[model samples]
Target chain A: MIRTLAGLVIVLILGAVAAAVIPEMQMREELQGVGYSYASRGMDETGSSNLVTAVIVAYRGLDTLGEVVVLFCASTAVVLMLTLYPIGVKASEPSRIVAFTAKVLPAPIMLFGVYFIAHSHLSPGGGFPGGTVIASTFLLVMLGSSSVPDRNGRLPAIESLAGLSFGLLGFWGIMTAGQFLNNAFLGTGTPGSIISGGLIPLISIAIGAKVASEFSGVFKAFRNSGGEA
Target chain B: MTETLMTAIVLTLGGMMVAAGIAVLFVRDLLSAIIITGFVSLSASVMFLLMDAPDVAITEASIGAVLATMIFLWGRGKIGDDG
Candidate 1:
């Protein structure tokens, strides 16, 4: 009886929300139509054909930096948590198929990740997706290998350096263009070209490296915590 | 006709997402639940693509479907099978 009552209440609430929201949904859709103007203008401003990349890497760059920092913190927390309970036993070797797949797949995956990051201004992909793809290659390695050595300090170092470089780039922009992340500090090459988005491609590279290292470090911490046990 | 077909596809994918969500809730095994959640993410990515948000679709497909599932499975292994 209580379950039925809860279901009925949920349905009623959903219906109410739908009734209240459906009309506004059309209005919201129309509002998004106005976003096309922003897209066109943003392309002109950033000299990137991909409006989303321009918005992310040029217009709202600080937000992206904060997101990467959040990722770094989360990875750091995972590392601290895993270190609290260290497991001495090593991981077991993967099966033949898994091992072979891991060996053959990482190269292509890395190449694709680089391509995705590099072509963010022209494609649907960017640093976040590309970084995740690259990190997955590391995950594949962790799964396939038994005695994966814990690189005591290297991953964190790379993550820190990437983050620092990203910040320094922002400072450089500030000094050069009087704004925190000004894209105009660098040349905004010809539109639809690989190096067109000025600081965007460089920022994407920094974000990709930071995110990739952070995630791989998280995976390493988890693996060392006797995840295979 | 295309609109009707598109609506049908959307409904089908939405149904699959709902089914996967319910399956995740009801599944007794942790690993199976994690895998079902991955399916939910995968369906959501398809929905994002259909909505003309390919960037979001890629992020969802890569991070949500693949990475989250792998991480969950790894965490599950650490927790052991008794749970």
Candidate 2:
């Protein structure tokens, strides 16, 4: 009874606080102008048509690096979870319907994923979305076949290479522009085109590889756990 | 013009999110509950985009759509049918 009362009191307090705070949290309408200005300047300076990509890769590259690290850490955690306990059972092959869909899905999805990442600097989608799609394609393959190739080793390899490349690129930026992760290596070109942004596309590719590997690792880990248990 | 339309869409998405949350609460099956939770994340991402937080929206959508969904699936298998 005491515990229940305590929980109720806590809930009441939380409710009161939320009621007070939520009014102030109304969506700030001023951001559209600010975001537009930042985007415009970014485009003029970086020669990238995609405002969001420029912000992500050039102005906030460090944050993007941190995001990648977070993904890598998540991948490690999932892999650990899978490896710590042995699940020796193998899953059966998918049904005919699942198999046919899985086989058909990968080609188009992978192609689209690649295109999105490559053109991230010039369009709406970016590395994370593209990478998730790529991972989903791999997941489909796993769903379709019991003999799906385990990609654990390859994942780590790609992750490490991407990490290394990102670091080297950032270092190059610091040397040239006195700012880390600057798109210094990417020469000036017209905006609103795929080839315009220098480091944006490169960064997008790196992020894509990292996200894909990390997500695939998670799916595999979960599958392994289910089979083992 | 597009902005106003976007705001209306965001409001609609927000309503759907509340409904999805309610649905998640009422759903008996754990897997279906998890799937509904994905829709909630998706709805939140749409709202974020409307608010001009595209970067945050992308992150939320990706993590919400991919990582959270996978985690929920694993949790379902572990928890079995228990409430």
Candidate 3:
């Protein structure tokens, strides 16, 4: 009772504070500094209609690569720990409804996921969200089946190759443009088209592959934990 | 009129998110808490859409509400679903 009351009091106080301060907060008038440049030149220079993708894959490519590395490390750690200490997972056959839905849904789900990754430069979704959708498809498959499907290390291989592709593309940029992950080396094609963003689309594909593989590996590890798959 | 409707919707979502966030802390069962947490994320996704960030909204809805909830439920199952 006392904890609830205390929480309520704290929330009320915070709400009051926010109400007092929010109206005074200034809204940004326009894109400025790096943001302005990215907004104006991002589409033309990178040839990606999606400004966000251009910035992520071209302007700050190294940082994005670092982020991918971070994801790799985290996924690696989870897989390693789970392998070391396997949980006893009993994979029971799901209900008829769930099994039927899972079987029917994965095809369309996979299609949407690929579309998301492929059209990321022209749309809102990029590698991360698209890759996650793909991983979720695998999750659905795992849930519907009676047993965990063994990939026999295919996921890790895909992950490594995808990660390698990202680095190789950067090195390719260095050879041509004297900069890592330069998207302009191939000549900026017409924006709003699929083949417009030079290295952006390629990098998105690599990132998408890496993310999907890593997440699938983690999910498979969880599903196959102590059970011999 | 449209602007006012959006503002009202945003305010409603924000209030529900706050309520859910608080309710999660008080909930005894772990499953209920996890579902409520997903609810909070779902509300936040709506708020992001209202703020003209469809990308953020999609990511949040998928990763936060869907993926995270599934992962949590899986973990809870592993640990024995008394939670």
The window of 10 residues in a row where model 1 chain A has the poorest summed lDDT is A25-34
Off by over 4 Å in 2: A1-8, A25-37, A87-90, A226-229, B1-13, B49-63
Order the numbered candidates by TM-score, best leading.
3, 1, 2
Selected candidate, larger DockQ, 1 vs 3: 1
For model 3, residues B1-83, the per-residue Cα lDDT tens digits are: 99899988988888888899989978888899899999998888888888887777888887897788988888888775463
TM-score of 3: 0.91
Q: For candidate 3, state the interface root-mean-square deviation in angstroms to 1 decimal.
A: 1.1
Q: What TM-score against the true fold does each predicted structure earn?
A: 0.90, 0.84, 0.91
Per-residue error (Å), model 1, residue B69 = 0.4
TM score of chain A per candidate:
0.87, 0.86, 0.89
What lDDT tens digits, residue by residue, belong to model 1 across residues A163-188?
Answer: 99999999999899988989976888
Q: Sort by lDDT, best first.
A: 3, 1, 2
Number of backbone clashes in candidate 3:
0
Q: How close is candidate 2 to the true structure, as a TM-score?
A: 0.84
DockQ of all candidate complexes: 0.77, 0.42, 0.71
Q: What is the lDDT of candidate 1?
A: 0.85
lDDT of 3 by residue, A1-229 (tens): 9998999899899999999999988898998899999998888899898887888889999999999999999999989999899888776768999989989999999899888889988999888888888888888888887766555768888999999999999999999999888889998799888888888888988999999889888889888778576
Per-residue alpha-carbon lDDT of model 2 for A1-229, expressed as tens digits? 9998998899899999999999988786665776777855877888887777888888889998997888788789868977887455447767899888888989998998898799887767889888888888878788787764564457778878878888888888888878788784668587776677877888788888888878887777777764542
